[model samples]
Target: MPYINVRLTRKDITTEQKAQIVREITATMQSVLGKRPESVHVVIDEIDPENWGYAGELTSVHRKRQG
Candidate 1:
């Protein structure tokens, strides 16, 4: 069995995008780890902008810095 935990900041990403990500990740795990799709569990966590940070800045601020 494969268990995946995905954490991301809440932004403008769509549900379809998230689903696609999950599918692709699961497929990759299935091929590499030889795990079945049904045995894989994917957990996506949408974090708050204030909670997720990088480079001593919150996600909202970090994104602007990158851009």
Candidate 2:
């Protein structure tokens, strides 16, 4: 089984975009590693910006500064 974890801050990502991500990842595993699509597990972990940090600051802070 190929387990893939996709972590992203909850933002403006559409439902179709999320589904496409899962489909492509599973396809990659199936093609590259010969893992069956049914055996490929893709987990999308949506995180709150306040809880996701980068460069010693939270993502929410980064976005606020950008705005």
Candidate 3:
């Protein structure tokens, strides 16, 4: 079995987008790693911007600055 974990900042992501992500990742593993789709597991964890940091600052702060 192949397991993949994806982490993203909580934002305006939609259900369709998340489904596409899981499908693509599953397909890649199936083709490249010879894993069965049924045996593959993909997990997505969405974190609040305030909980995610980069460049010594919170992601929320970074996005605000970008805007």
TM-score for all predictions?
0.81, 0.94, 0.95
Cα lDDT tens digits, model 2, 1-67, are 7788999999988989999999999988988889989899998999999999999999999999999
- Where does candidate 1 stray beyond 4 Å? 63-67
What is the full ranking by TM-score, best candidate first? Answer: 3, 2, 1
lDDT top scorer: 3
lDDT of 3 by residue, 1-67 (tens): 7889999999989999999999999999989989989999999999999999998999999999999
Q: lDDT (0-100) at residue 26 of candidate 2?
A: 92
* Model 2 pairs in collision: none
Compared with the true structure, model 1 gives a TM-score of 0.81
- Go through the candidates in order and give the C-alpha RMSD of each one to the true structure: 2.0, 0.7, 0.7
Cα-based lDDT at residue 58, candidate 1:
88
Better of 2 and 3 by lDDT: 3
